[model samples]
Target: MSASAQGYVAAELARGGYQNVHDLLSQACATHPQRTAFSCGDDHLTYAELGSRADAFARYLRYHAGLQPGDRLALQLPNCLQYPIAVFGALKAGLVIVNTNPQYTAAEARHQFHDSGAKAILVLDRLLPLVRAVQADTELQQIILTSVDDLQQPIYESQEDGTLRFMQALRLGEQRSPVQREAGLDRLALLQYTGGTTGVSKGAMLTHRNLLANVLQTIELFDQPGLLEPEKDVRIAPLPLYHIMAFATNCLSSVGMGLHTVFIRDGRNLDETIGAMQRHPFSLLSGINTLFVGLMNHPEFRRIDFSHLKWATSGGAPLNSEVGRRWQALTGAPIREGFGLTEASPVVATGTQLSPYREGYIGQALIETELRTVDDEGNDVPPETPGELWLRGPQVMQGYWQRPDETAKVLTPDGWLKTGDIALLDADGFVKIVDRKKDMILVSGFNVFPNEIEDVLMQHPSVRECVAVGVPDARKGEAVKVFVSLKDDTVDERALLEHCRQYLTGYKMPSFLELRDELPKTAVGKLLRRQLRDEASAAAS
Candidate 1:
């Protein structure tokens, strides 16, 4: 088969009349009004109810908050019943969504809020303090908060200096007409922030067309044999909705197909997540490698009935073959490994349960998405040769928001997004990711740059210099290990780690800290991260 024919699978599916996600939501609501669209514990919302609430929120944004179309609205909440309400509401109101991670500290929150220029934010009531800390420096004009129990327990707390309860906003919007605005497919829908080649965070400008295309691509794959059933499939939402992959798959695609999504507010709590699985005979589940391993390792996982589980999709990080085989042995369902990045609206390719599972290879490019492994000279490498992976598709983000120079570095003029990962494409189009070009560490599926860690460590007065490298781990696919050269004679690993804990998230935190005499450096005084990585690998071996 020719290289052009690699994406032939996409051509088999048709692009329907839906212009944007709003249209998709409208269609789902119209088709399955009574079906459960989203649920978290006892709190549930039907498609009709979800749509109505979204419309109400839209109305509030337009009339009460005085937000116009194309404005940015930040959503900083965990996986709960209110997540979809805020997301769909922002879309219906023609506002660009900035999906902010609730795990972000005040400083991290400040960067995203300031970068996106978000006018309004839908945050959790408990996380109001984090938002308040950065609100003064941002363009935020309105603050709407929601609690996990707000659906069961009415939260009418509002009128407190630019702050309002999520329920209150919904009630206010319910009084007014729903916001009506038509946006082109090219209009920006989301400002999904990502740490690109450089450690600095940049927003990927995802247009409505990009997200819609990726959703269609995923839906087409799910429609194949033994994958996803429409109304009958109940999926477990363990991954955070703030992440692009979860946002696309769990929130949009699953909801569009009328699949019941059972939300687990904290995926880290394997006990509750397993309990949730036992309660519902869920047919479909999606998560990263760490999540799969965590569940399989849990004692309660053996007690849960896997009779109804049809397919388990893995992404976020490299899927371990041993974990996959063990998962199948326990659950009787092989884990299908998929590949994606935040830049591509997250879903580029996925392995299918219908076929024999490959250990390391991510399945062929999704229908209509083209993939190629290119050399340093920007020429395509031969089949099975490792090279930088490049992708082109309707799902690719427009570019990095407010960073044209940074955008040009990765994206080619012809539309191909140069993924900084080294991969090999077989003649059959299966992509095997061999290595990453950038020194980014994948800690349990989250991207952690070495530079980010070094920067944080540099802030400490006792630290002279530091280099962070990913070390092999038994549990997490990779763990952060920082080697430090101290300025003072005394060495305090705890103090250095404590300083890092203040700036970095849990996943990004270094699990191992080693005080070293010196780290490898280039002739030009540049830190040789790869050398440190090689040393770690050698030591492990």
Candidate 2:
């Protein structure tokens, strides 16, 4: 099956249609001109309208902003109509996109902008102050700003520090001649920054072929079971698009399939998220465990109609078995968990509708993708044995931007990219991610995985959210520390410890546990275990 899927992907690409990301957009627009491409709140854009606006932005960047092909353009906006316009326009203008998180701090923003050497930035007005704080530190020559309602309503232009409003830029670009640049498959298309969980964030350089191939690979998998129908499926995109997973899935794959995507700017806002669901009656949905747990806890979640829902996906982090079971029970649709890192264009393995759901398994690798589990010595591990996961495929990135030394650490010269994840491969070829390689806890010379501890804790009804990390212990070398937020205040720490004692071994049990109002997480709802570990180490010191 893997070999045939690889052949099919190669044949599909060899047939020659959409050579670049912009070409993908063009094809979608031509095929579904009247269909809705994207929506946020009450504002939406048809395929044709999206294409026209993207073209205008492309022309504006080339003619007005004076950006050349291969130049970097940073997009720092939430999920809104302007995001697609900026993304497609930047691609159309032959510019590489640097997707910046709107919630980034000044230091984080400065690092990404300076590192990417972005020539221009399209930012949301609310975040202009943060941009202003970091713009002088970057090489940015142009600043294009937009408000949430800029596309839906007219607003007077604010010429603050020679910045151009998003709508104004579009209007001005429409008057200029169209831009026609040849962006080949090998040309770099994106600088997707990884979460600096290990250290400073590094940008993973993705090319046109890398993204386009992943899109084709994903479409092939979805098409096998008729899970997605072009111009028919309504996908709810509540995750931040700046993240690689969402970018590849929602921005690239969904567009290629001509699926209507409803963007929820803030998934944390339960009211707004539930409202969007009420409005769209979506057929497809994607989210993380935190989001699923939050929605299930909300009263409105039960009221929203899930009749049209055909498929659901979970990624960005491991899906707790309890959470998955609850989600399936509530929606009548099982959540198929997938796994990937930014270096692999954010998708390597995902479960298809044809595959039976398995707890903790991320199913098989995508078409044209290869997977390996290896020991620390780089030798292949036995099947079903936990080791570092290695992948090789079209979706693997070219390398880290301007960081060959850093790139060499993860990517082998033989073309396999070390995923830095501890995983196991079963006889059926299913991949089960155990935990991050760096996050493993060593207690008295025994290796303890935090995902195992957290998964067990999540089965307790009183545990709302939790993360387990290894903290310093003079006696044990390192001890398990579990941090949790509760759903029921009646359940005390003793009860939680007793619950853990029932499921965990003596060495695996938490030596220290702390209750928090909430845990730290990335913008995409991934737990910040590294941060918690750092804090715990500091406290121990």
Q: TM-score, each model?
A: 0.96, 0.82
Model 1 TM: 0.96
| Tens digit per residue, CA lDDT, model 2, 21-82 | 88878888778899999999998999999999999999999999999989999999888888
Cα deviation at 366, candidate 1, in Å, is 0.1
Clashing pairs in 1: 10-367
Per-residue lDDT for 20-44 in model 1, tens only? Answer: 6787778888898898888888778
* Candidate 1 residue-wise lDDT at 70: 93
Which residue segments of model 2 deviate by more than 4 Å?
1-4, 195-198, 440-541
lDDT of 1 at 81: 85
